[model samples]
Target: MKRICFLYCMIFVFLLMPNIVGATQSRDDGLSQFMFGISYNELLDTGDIRSHKAEFLAGEEIQGVFEEYDTLLYDKKNGYMELHLDASPCDCPGKITAAAYAKRNGGYLFLRNKETTCIYRHVNGIVASEPITSYMPVGFGLQMFLPEHFSLPKNDEAAFFLTAEIPRQGTTTTLQLKQIPFGLYVPSTTLLIDDAPLALADKAKEVEQINDPQLSLENGSFYKTYHNIHESALIFFDPEQFNDEAYPTELPKKELQDMLLSGNLSAIGEKDRHILEKLGAYASSYPPITLEHMSERFRFFYMVYQVEQNLVWDTCTMEWDSVAGRFRITKKWLSRKKPASFLEFLRDADFWVAAC
Candidate 1:
């Protein structure tokens, strides 16, 4: 089964053929900083290439509260900067347009996740353009940047670079990027969320505890559910799209239970980091992650509130251990046996800042 999945992943890569990959990729011993690149199919005849120009303004403001994308930044100002391509004339589909590179050692380190995760449309302040319909899958080598070849790290150096292929120099869309600070508008002081309905243990107890999952795919099974979140106030989890059964009920952990009962989301992240990681990357062959059945083989399960994507998932895994006779939670692995979650894979301090 794993062999088949491996072949499938290879085929998937072959199909995309990635005009180029590696710049955005990290070595098993290295890390990947977010890089953006723009590319255009080069002209067939000319060894000569045209030049395009655009400018990015730093510190632009945006208003709508979007997830993941809400946090934005510039390369240089935050100790991160784009790699200078020198704009040499070139002709090829593989040619790069523009890219963002981490400029400082602090910038390149995965623990420092200083790369941009999403772009926002500036309307007074960063606002949501639209919910992303697609995501850049892992193990695909951060699709946009081109690989950089050089000796070991520099004395005054950041190790990674990002590159993009720009269209013929005169194209209408000139490349302009800005590094901005991310500010979350949670109405922190003025408001509080009502997680009360969700923490009702009595109601949860009334619901049957299942030994099986609600859905099982080649990747894994649906493990848990997001409780008390409304179909309306959320960008994801529209009731119209999913039915009650698709969202599995979880016996809220002590941390979440307290938050639900108290209306405070503070420090809730401190205790359940493991569960959160599982929720983010648990395998699912299905798109948009819909699970449909259950089984005892799918015992260990949990859910996480994904602030990055403003989405949520219930991670289900068959892997578990009993330490000294009590259930011991261990990190889950994907079908390929790669570390299953992004948070698990990266384990960077910056990610904790952005994600937590």
Candidate 2:
């Protein structure tokens, strides 16, 4: 019985040894190791060109960390590997030539600048190169590649890094690295205004007005009218239209004459009128009507009070024509305004600034 028990124990240990060894090997191999690249296409192209000076980095830990990937290939030559960097000007145009390199050993990579000879190591696929002292007519940048065998460092994490160096009248170089989580996806949704579905007609009209090819005087009549109304609280006056003494007077007397001819103005219903009136009243209170002074407009200005942050202030302006029973609201009218309670609008503007 003792002899039989000993033999069974030996068999059990043998069966478990391979799995234990495999686990240890995996830990040593640094699973999910990260690698970064500037652009994949450039790296692949570098590989096709067979440029020895260039290199490529590959590992599993790199994903969303690098913003772009370079296209390059690796070929083994006499117990070592050589990278080929080639440039095709038609597709990609930019300064700075970049490449990534890695050896079979897990140690980090160090790059030496030919001129300055300053050395830097690759940190999570980001390597900062020394400044360019030599004068080159063209630009230079880095191109990096990521290997497929590498996996994400985490389930859904991403990171990015950017660097740029431009010499006076010499070559300009830029490098960026990005890593993202594995198997990530995002869904699209319909855009809404004032908690209501945006009308396709209005959207189409906006697109047409923005992209109209003709640059004639009539083409921008409505836009010009809107700007004048916002700045002076009046229609296109004599002094605003043109400086020509022969045609000093305003050209169009009717409210919709020039706008209708320009295909920018259209008929509106009572509901639209009510909305415009409310928006106009809100916009008239703000000052500094310059284009850069406007704030981000909200569909429901009142709802801003409910947000946790007090950054909901906005301005809304509209131009009303009592004679024609028509009005127009300019995009600038839907901007945010500073509140008097926040120390003369200074504090309020600071609150609304988005985080970098």
Best by lDDT: 2
Task: Give the per-residue lDDT digits (tens) of candidate 1, residues 1-356.
Answer: 99999999999888776644544442211211223222222211112212111111232221121122222222222222222222222211111112222223222221111112222111011111111111111221111111333112111211112111222222111111121111111111111111111111222231233322322222322212221011111211223322325433242444343343334544545334333323322333322222111111111011111111111111212111112211121222212122344234222111101110
lDDT per prediction?
Answer: 0.22, 0.25
Residue-level lDDT tens digits of model 2 in 1-356:
99999999999999999996665422112211211232333433433332333332332221121123333222212111111212322232222222222233322121211111111111122222222211111221111122234221221111122232212121222222221110111111211111111222223343243233221124333333233323322212223432334222233333322332233333533443333333333335432222111111111111222221232212222232223222232322213333443122222211110111
Whole-model lDDT, candidate 2? 0.25
Task: Give the poorly placed runs of model 2, Cα more than 4 Å off.
Answer: 1-39, 42-53, 56-218, 221-226, 232-309, 312-338, 341-356
Task: Return the lDDT, model 2, position 165.
Answer: 27
Q: Single out the weakest 10-residue window by summed lDDT for candidate 2.
A: 114-123
Per-candidate TM equals: 0.16, 0.18
Model 2 CA lDDT for position 213: 27
For TM-score, the strongest prediction is 2
Q: What is the lDDT of residue 285 in candidate 2?
A: 42
Model 1 stretches astray by more than 4 angstroms: 1-33, 37-72, 80-107, 110-298, 302-356
